[model samples]
Target: MSKNLVIIGSGGDARETLEAVEAANQAGTADYKVLGFIVEARYGTPGALVSGLPILGDFDWFAGRAGEVVAVGAVGSPVLRYRLVERAARYNIEFGNVIHPGAVISSSVRLGWGVIVEAGCVLTSQVRLGDHTHVNLACSISHDTVLDDFATLSPGVHLAGRVRLGEGCFMGIGSVVIEGKQVGKWSVIGAGSVVIRDIPDRVTAVGVPTKIISSQPPANWITQSGEK
Candidate 1:
């Protein structure tokens, strides 16, 4: 039997997640029947259509349906995604994951709940992806790479062997991290940057052999209203 699933977000990432679910279903790798999207009340209206799926309601939509449905966070921002996951967990919601059929993942890879590995992604042996992590289109994670909770890898990002991304880190599109590097929690690597060394927490780095361009406190990234 197929289980009911909902995506927590109604934006482009959510639609792309829906497509991954559909592809997984078609490939016979998953038996989930995606019901719709559920976002914050401020972001969506009930019955609105998104990529042909209904905007079921807000987080409150899970009030009586937690036992019957699973959810996956699809927000693009790592901090926002973490906030959404924590919010949904209050309803005792069980999180689901999406692995697009086009992704090639090693048998030794370990993935946590709510992780999304999109099309053309290649996760090599011993890779570990923590809860609510998002590996976007065409990203490549080499052997033993680890992505902590709510980490976001933009399209075409590449991580060399043994790299570790701390919680809520965001690697921008086309970014590259060399072997044995560590990106600290909530750090941001700008698009096309090449990280050759370790990055500290709550900083933004860019350039070839990336440089720390800016830094902020945790409160700046995670706000009470969940806005970045």
Candidate 2:
């Protein structure tokens, strides 16, 4: 029997994950039946349509559906994603992976729960992606790289071999990290930056050869309104 899945957002990312699940179902590679979404009630009314699927309820809706329905976060913000996962944990919610059919992932790669590998992504051998990592479209992660939990790789980013990304790091679109460098936890690499050296925690870096512009903490991934 197919496992019922609940996507935990109703935005574009949620739609993309839904498409990946549908593709997996069509390819007969994974047994998943998408039941609908769990949007924060402010987004829409319960039972209303999102990406052609009904909005089932909010974060608390999964409490009664344990074991019968699994969840995967479609939101991009690491902090918010972490918060949602923690909330779900109170009810013993189980999470699943949403890998796009167009993406290429090696058998040797280790993926954690609620991981989302979007379309056109190529993950090479020995890549260890941690729980709730969000890899956006057309990115390339080379061999032996480790991405810790809640890391977000924006579209068209490239990582050379042996790179290590700490927990909750965000690499903006078209960014490139060279071989063997480490990006510390909760750091944000701005768009199109080329990282050639190590970046410390809780700062925003940007430039051709990425430089630490300020020592400020990362912008709140979760806004007051709870949107990414």
Candidate 3:
């Protein structure tokens, strides 16, 4: 039986997920015949197609059929992806993960549901990746790293041992987090930055030692003076 799958969002990450799904289909390791992608009616691109899969409908239109399909949140923005996932959760949408053909994941590593691990990525022993997290192309996550839900690592990001990343965080391409560092929720680590210490929640940090720049309030953070 060809299990049906529908992807959410229409973007670079979605395209990559399509490729991974194709790979899975070809190998028969995963059973999925793509029904199409679902997006907002205004953004669904009515006649537009991805690899011959039509844009199904708006999320509301698609909700009734979610029970018969598997889906993935393929947006690049960690914050945006989390929001999307939360929306889908109301419909009890089941999220499927895309693991590229060449990534190496250790048996001791614990991967949560809805995660995507692109090619050339390495997950060492005891690593824990939270739900909806993305480990992009060529990234390396060393032993004992814990990446929270909806966190993302752009291409070539490297995370050393025992590093902890909070929910909805984004690590820019080539960013490097040294061992024993922890990044707080909703933080952004710019490309090529080196993290050596703890970063506060909702802050954007850049530089070798990763000093916090002025951080805006997170979507859920309500306060005038950075206070909880």
Q: What lDDT does each candidate get? A: 0.93, 0.89, 0.84
For model 1, give the 10-residue run with minimal summed lDDT: 218-227
Number of the candidate with higher lDDT, 2 or 3? 2
TM-score quality measure for candidate 2 = 0.93
TM-score of each: 0.97, 0.93, 0.92
Top model number, lDDT = 1
Worst 10-residue lDDT window, candidate 2: 216-225
Best TM-score among the predictions, by candidate number: 1
The true-versus-predicted C-alpha distance at residue 6 of model 2, in Å, is: 0.4
Backbone clash tally (model 1): 0
Which residues of candidate 3, in runs, are more than 4 Å off? 218-228
Query: On residues 84-132, what C-alpha lDDT tens digit does candidate 3 reach at each position?
Result: 6766767887888788877889999988888889889999999999999
List RMSD in Å for every model shown: 1.3, 2.6, 3.2
Backbone clashes in model 1, listed as residue pairs: none
The per-residue C-alpha lDDT of model 2 at residue 9 equals 84
**Between prediction 1 and prediction 3, which has the larger TM-score?**
1
Quote the RMSD, in angstroms, for model 1: 1.3
Q: For model 3, give the RMSD to the true fold.
A: 3.2
